[model samples]
Target: MRVPRSAAVWMACCMALALAGCGADKVEASGTTDENGACVLTIGTLGPLAGPAADFGLSMKGTADLAAAEVNQQGGLRVGERTCHVRVSAYDTGYTSAGAANGAGEFIGQGIRFVIGPMGATEVTGMKPLAGRNDMLLVANGFGRDALQPQYPLVFHVAPGPSVWAAPIIAEARKHFSFNKVTIVATSDQSGSDIADVNEIRFTQAGLPVSRESYQRGTQDFAPIVSRILGHDPDLVDLASTPAADAGTMVKQLRQAGYTGTFCRLGGESTAEIARVAGGNDVLGNFFYYSMVDLSDPRMQHLSAEYEQIAGRPATSLTLGWLPAARALLRAISAAGTTTDTQAVAARLRQDPLEDPDLGRGVWTGQQEFGVDQEMSFPFYMGYIRDGQPQPLVRLEATQP
Candidate 1:
């Protein structure tokens, strides 16, 4: 995460929060920016802001912002005996590795010790060196397998990886979508391939035939790929890709191709912008996807309401994942009891695992769901789009069996 000179005011403000210790080690935390010597804790997000995948970044930004506000209003986080208000800092990486690295650098330059994203797995991978250099604790909001490897110690992924969805989606395929054949469309990126490349094996094992094709992550034209897939005439279509401008565009082309069949999209990223670009609920029907939906889980209801109030936007996957990440990190801070030590916080996150307040009786550790031991904290759900809404398809459960 190399720092660039042109960092925006949003980046600068977050840096300032980190420098000021985020009311964690303040002389006296008055809970206002003007308060003298108040500690300020900066949580940074490294996702695209205004490029192809800007919608995901925007969703991340909104949820992160909501988390910050909720933490502040709850009278701040309790670190040992002191309380420090949480503040979120956002940086737009523009969906490129270099851009993500630059944002990470800027946050590190300004003393930001904690980050919420670099959400895309590739972006997170690129920022590893920088986060290591600055000793930052990163909570990634994207695919997990890429970040959950043994070596990447600074980051914790709250989202379930591909394996979680592969089996479940396959099961759904058996139940609802009968097939002798299927066509798959995925982005031509490492993470996408990691998830998409397995369609043949998984599909055949489930007693269904499958064919696949992939395009570059930012490629919008799906005409050729659609033609080829439709030529084979798949019983159902699998979109094993992330939500970006390309994803929405690809769906439109498929719809126009007169391929009105079952469409199931794994994982999640949603926004008003995407809905608008898709133009009138065209891509809504038969869209199956996975996302965080603990709304009725008692544990998440409070935070969900708090987010809806603060951001003035409907609560979705972004808010659901972001709030938990905030609480998880805050718990780490409380356990470690220091604002300046990134490594110490990382250790706390790894070793101290926090219990989910959303599920009143169960305790979860940071390592459990991610790599640790908490099942009650991190759970995955399945859903399908019907009448333009993603209704929950499975109860929230841990990533692995």
Candidate 2:
């Protein structure tokens, strides 16, 4: 019999709780040792795998799996005298606080020492306490103002937040499209409000008048929100933190309402999906957005080729964003020489240079913004779409906070 999604999640959580009770003694420094004396390590991935933001979560899972596979294929990670074979366990959080909390519990019950996601702001907030208390290392992706606070030493950011990149992107967009006034649309939850708050500050500081509009999550018909947004008579509309699917629907509705304005998404990368959802590239005329990775780079191309070889399909730009952090986690574990002691792993991660063969080099930033230098800041792309055709992406260097 086919089980309902919610039922399946509930059953999984229950099983995890039972396991926590039964396996308390079995939990050790890391994974089990094989007959060949190889350490088998399991890393947990927490994210939404069955919701509007599933695209981002699935990308996170894919990249983490790829990182693990790469390590295993290279004869596993060498930690002192032992070899470690990495494995990945993924749990879908459904992009909710309760889901994230439950997913964290599942990981804890399974004795997972490291985790790779819980990308949304709410998901990060929900999972942080449990992960901190259990001494789990997290390479998280979230845009909340407190996503990388000093209190959470084990938590590290996968990418810099809008506070670091938004101003530069806004300046670049102004060069191509003139816009004096902006309307920002996002969801009504913390994830939306947090990112929208940052974007508003950045836009206002750039001397542009800004207005805000929001809708309840899971609202399929965006006609009312579109009407409200159009009432502001904006020259530019910024989809601050809307999921790609929701942003696509909003783009379609706004277009149908006869609003001819430039569009910008200063949040996550989902341009292709957004364009597809908005009908076609032509419908997304004069659009600007952020790309997590610059695909034009030959190194990035090689990374894509490697992913296609391993995953049997092309990797999305979003998936590429998670690669560096996932790979870094394994390297840190090797450097620390212990998978169980996350504190040591975090230390090694901070000391090591944030460099990747395919993605290039990054810096450990966020000290100025979050009072901790745990966020990874990589060079990203500011992409433009004009008259429904994509323009050559403008590569931007990573900026310091």
Candidate 3:
């Protein structure tokens, strides 16, 4: 008999609840699946550990693990009088929906109460039922709209939404490009369309008349759409896509067709590796994107140093997104003093006001004021791809969108 997605977590729920001891045993850390639930209260970050977007998942995972290590070092999460050192069960989702669903089942079987995950939209959707069934809270790192919409009460988003991103991209365009006309091209999927929605709303709101085209995620030819965009004589083109190999193909075709207008991408790919495949110089110079944090900022210099030690690479703004979300869950669990019931912690997330600097470098408010929508209140930073690297635009002052 095939178990339902939620059943896996539900079956393990009793075992997990029994196994939930708020005791701070020696903090044992390992990066293997065989070690699941070997220690009390295991938490995890699920994503590609050795796949195509491995760099993307690994960088974020490194930061999450580092955050866990830091908390555990301080004697772990304090649930009332008991201190529980967190054990992490990091899993790879292989950047596929099926892989993510299976990963969710594994974490449930391991009897985990909290999870950080599968950094893409499809993957998050795959794991949603499992999280909901277990009543376990999932802090998602991706900006997929489905996770937020249709409301996963048990799931929380740490990264700001695409709505948080769009206004800033338009604002930056005004400084660098003539704001006469614009075109937006996006994937037909939920994540892509959601980002396009933000771009369309903000583009006109920013006082620039905009035109748009929606394309399938992996379409080989954009010339037909590019032809339509060029007819508008657009000064700018917004390309919104999920991070994957297909986005690279689209970027290459756009540039190869001699489209000179600036093309700004939403969430840059794994490591600018997309640049190499998508025509390094041409693609990098014209890309406008949202980067969650700036490693160059003196404020984030500390995290940059630490990220290098942890992930073996300089931290990008996106790396900062996962840690704060994970920490938020840990904080709620600590404040509520119980792991068996996430409701108390969920209530704190709903009832209590939060202003955390580490999460998103500013004050945070939950659904109480925002109507069951806000996960964190970190402001978005406008970024551009420069010289084969992603960097902050720097000219536009930061503001909430």
Top TM-score model: 2
- Per-candidate TM vs. native? 0.79, 0.91, 0.76
- CA lDDT of each prediction against the hidden true structure: 0.61, 0.82, 0.61
Off-target runs (Cα >4 Å) in candidate 2 are 1-30, 34-37
Residue-pair clashes per candidate, as listed?
18, 0, 2
Better of 2 and 3 by TM-score: 2
Worst 10-residue lDDT window, candidate 1: 2-11
What candidate 1 gets wrong by more than 4 Å, as runs, is 1-35, 198-205, 269-283, 294-305, 352-354, 359-377, 386-392
Measured by lDDT, the strongest candidate is 2
Off by over 4 Å in 3: 1-39, 48-56, 142-146, 149-151, 207-233, 267-271, 279-283, 351-354, 357-371, 385-392, 395-401
lDDT, candidate 2, 1-401, per-residue tens: 33323223323432343344321222224456768866888888888887678888888888887777666656666564567788889998988889989998998898887999888899999989999999988999989988988889999998888888899999998888889999999999988999999999999999999999999989988889999999999989999889989999899888988989999999888888898899988888889998888777676676677678777877888787778788777767766667787887787678656666566678888987789989888888899998788899887888685
Q: Can you write out model 1's per-residue Cα lDDT over 1-401, one digit (the tens) per residue? A: 32222112223333344444542433222222326655567677778878766767766777667656655654555554456767877898877668779998899787787887776657876787788777887777556345554456776765545545566666864554455677777767755665665555566677777777777766646678778878878767777655546666666677777877766665454533344655545564566665555456544565566566666766666566555566556656655667667666776666533334342222343352246532224555566565566555565455443
lDDT of 3 by residue, 33-87 (tens): 3334332456778887774467667766775765666565554555654566667
Q: How big is the RMSD of model 2?
A: 9.2
Find the 10 residues in a row with the least total lDDT in model 3.
23-32
RMSD (Cα, Å) of candidate 1?
Answer: 8.2
